[model samples]
Target: MNDSREQYTLANGRTSINALPKVSLHDHLDGGLRPATILELADSIGFEVPASDAASLGEWFEDSADSGSLVDYLATFDITVGVMQTTEGLTRVAREFVQDLAADGVVYGEVRWAPEQHVAKGLTLDQTVEAVQQGIEQGIDDARGEGKTLRVGQLVTAMRHADRGLEIAELAVRHRERGVVGFDIAGAELGFPAGNQRAAFDYLAQNFLPVTVHAGEADGLDSIRGALFDGRALRLGHGVRLAEDIRIESSDDENTFVSIGGLAQWVKDREIALELSPSSNLQTGAIAAWGDDLQDHPFDLLYQLGFTVTVNTDNRLMSNTSLSRELSLLSDAFGYDLEDFEVFQLNAANASFLPLDERQDLADTIIAGFQSA
Candidate 1:
């Protein structure tokens, strides 16, 4: 497990970040597996791993992912996805995923993974979804036993570089009533645009299914434009690069003047949440144009500009981070406090795939938790 998973407190030490209610919208299922679990699963499948012990293996994932390239960062998934080709592997990893989220104080989470990737071991798409749903259910029960309440849903993902977009979208709609809450297109964002999956997006639109697109991370504004125009995304995963559209015209001691592009204004006015993962964004070079440090991230700028920004851990093991750690890092970088954190949780809850009533209920729970804390 990541050492960052330890409890984090506000900068002033007034509140415990781990004790605050949070929501995670962009976390990846395969990317959040525990290092110890990876070792066990790899051993059971006779798969070769780079390290023998959990600590070294965890460090290997973090170190390898530190390269400032999205492709290089994504290559670390080969080891994680390699051992998750069977029902046992999928179920166990998923169960532990929720347990970890609960431990991190995430009251609601959406776990996204490409089902097409897990069918390499002969399991059908439906079977893989079923196995994961089973694991999620068990994990919920386990959390309840531990005196925590966690509600999680699956976000079925299609590989953008592959030809299974339509199939994966259909699978997601098929299981909407079971456990799959929404659909997404992830992987290799530079070359493959969401428009490439036009048929799948059309079908999802016709079905009234919510969609979140991975845009503005590896690619630029054109990719994000395609995601908004063609994919009809409800949220933008790691849309940190949308900051590229905002131009600073002039700055003063008291007030700074800037111009927002049409696209940036639209996303802001529409309240489309930008799922911002600080450490992962840094690791993948998503924020390189701005700077190489957390303080340099556009997250504070986006928030100050009235954008719907939600914090997330895109990949826990790879980034060696958790939701609390992400919040803690942001707090330290921007000097945020409890009120700022509460707004972030509220944004995520409102942007979640859950129905309107449930979202309100979640917002209420978050407000109550923060108030009590």
Candidate 2:
């Protein structure tokens, strides 16, 4: 269990909301490695870590990630990926990632990671996926042993900063029958447009594979446009920048009139899920155009405007957060209670890459858990 995932609750005086079932759609597998696990993995490889002990190393990650720039914040991934090169390291880290999520009460999760980053230790791309899958299976059984039931899917991600999109996409499709569920383009989102990976997106479309693109996080609407149009992304990784298209025409105390641009209207009407990570958004300056705090995030506006908004922790270790903590912060910032949190979970359940029947099952599980809560 990740002791860092302390119990959290809504301000409405409910019991531990952390104990309530949740879904994670945009979490990263490589980005959620435990500090102690990294230390152990690095030691076996004779690799040097920034901090000596787990406690200090965890603090170093948290401090380094608060740079308020997505590019700078992503620099911390070097250490996490450094330790995750071998099959054993990948499997162990993935196992612990699921265990941590299960401990935090996540019933369902889709973990995304770029396989290209893990080949340094002579493991083939397919071998890396299999390793992580083995760990996920182990984690599930371990969680069940401790009376905590959880399900996880792998979203094979291609780094947008690199040129292996089509190769990685093919890898994801090859592993679909094994354990993979979806495909994603991650890493630096700006400059590296989804259009750069047109071949990969086209191949995925031909194969009818599900895709979710990292857009509107470090970039603007054009990137999101490419994600939807060029990449045919089923969901936006962090489409908070879609708010840029919303024109607040007039406002008053009682109500406010607004006009959403064609793109914003399209996303809202199409019910595209905005996988918004509140603290990460603020830390990485994804919401800097609005303000510098959670209250300033377009999440509230997007949620109020009827856009499909779902809470997530994009990188639990880098952001030092979990789905539970994200919900607590959102609740505090927006005065949300259990009902609002339930709505977010329902939105995520509907937007999940799971099949119709499985999505319905997840929704049922979420509803039942929230009711029990």
Candidate 3:
């Protein structure tokens, strides 16, 4: 799926969606590595891969991730994290990750990954962060040389099943002035509530660090509640399940009557961003309550209710998509137009972990891009 060459045009034929400036909020570093890069890095580390060729390896990843069960889908990350042990491998993968995002027309992106999973090759926590920062800087320079301006920040993540929450939190705060911008918790979200990482959340809160939790994906409103009350999360990663809190009483051709639950009201009133990744949600069964198709996803309902909904590609390689493609898919499913697309971009830009001034700049860039489009 060479999505870089795929261009989507609007019905008006006035703009190519791929050329529009975009903001990526929920992308994963480990999950976005190039298939060829993974092969080369794995060979360098003498790590055995399931497939020998790059094409086959790419298919293998897509197949492995397509499993409906979350556990089976997560098993695929073992291979990616296995090869990302050394500093060189991490740096190369990070660098190419930015290059790929730049080619996909992402002007600003937050790359999330769990550092604890990359300690197999004996690199210290600080060293691993430094290595990834170096690669991001190199990738930025490369994008500049190619006449594309891109900025990326690291959203340091802690595995929910791991006991290193406070440790990873401190590491993120230590690197705040470097490339790290925020903190997140990912993994099985159903059983491992954000409350389990109270110490880390406390430390991050006292330090005034921004947080986003992987909630409302594999779990329900209770998990989202924990993310807000315990994790103090500023954003919800794949908070698609928050739609469960929205109860529809009746509807007509003119309007739909609905009632909002307390949790849903707070999230909507507070304007917490929902990182909705359409394809990934379908593959992971996150929207199984609604249906197995994009059209059945609650993304349209949430957007209609003004939930600060932002489109994303959770894992570009695994989901085999990009932000542009995600936007295209959403537009196709929900019959959204340029105005709706621009709203999604603006929502992501405002919800980014960057400083207020930087976020303002990002918004300005998006406005300019859409104006020209």
Which numbered prediction scores highest in TM-score against the true structure?
Answer: 1
For model 1, residues 1-373, the per-residue Cα lDDT tens digits are 5643598898777788999999999999999999999999999989999999999999999999999999999999999999999999999999999999999999999999999999898999999999999999999999999999989999999999999899999999999999999999999999999999999999999998899999999998998899999999999999999999999765566676889999999999999999999999999999999999999999999999999999999999999999999999998899889999999999999999999999999999999999999
Estimate the TM-score of every prediction.
0.98, 0.97, 0.97
Query: What is the per-residue lDDT of model 3 for residues 134-190, given as tens digits with 9 covering 90 to 100?
Result: 999999999999999989999999999889999999999999999999999999887
Assess the local accuracy of residue 133 in candidate 1 as a C-alpha lDDT between 0 and 100: 98
lDDT of 2 by residue, 1-373 (tens): 3343688877766668888889999999877988888889899999999998998998899899998899999999999998888889999998999999899999999999999999997999999999999999999999999999889999999999898999999999999998899999988898999999999999999998899999999999999999999999989999989999998865566576889999999999999999999988988999999999899999999999899999999988888888888998888899988889999999999999999999999999999998998
Model 1 worst lDDT run, 10 consecutive residues: 248-257
TM-score of 2: 0.97
Q: What is the C-alpha RMSD of each candidate to the true structure, in Å?
A: 1.2, 1.5, 1.5
lDDT of predicted model 3: 0.91
lDDT (C-alpha, whole model) for all candidates: 0.95, 0.91, 0.91
Off by over 4 Å in 3: 251-256
What lDDT would candidate 2 get against the real structure? 0.91
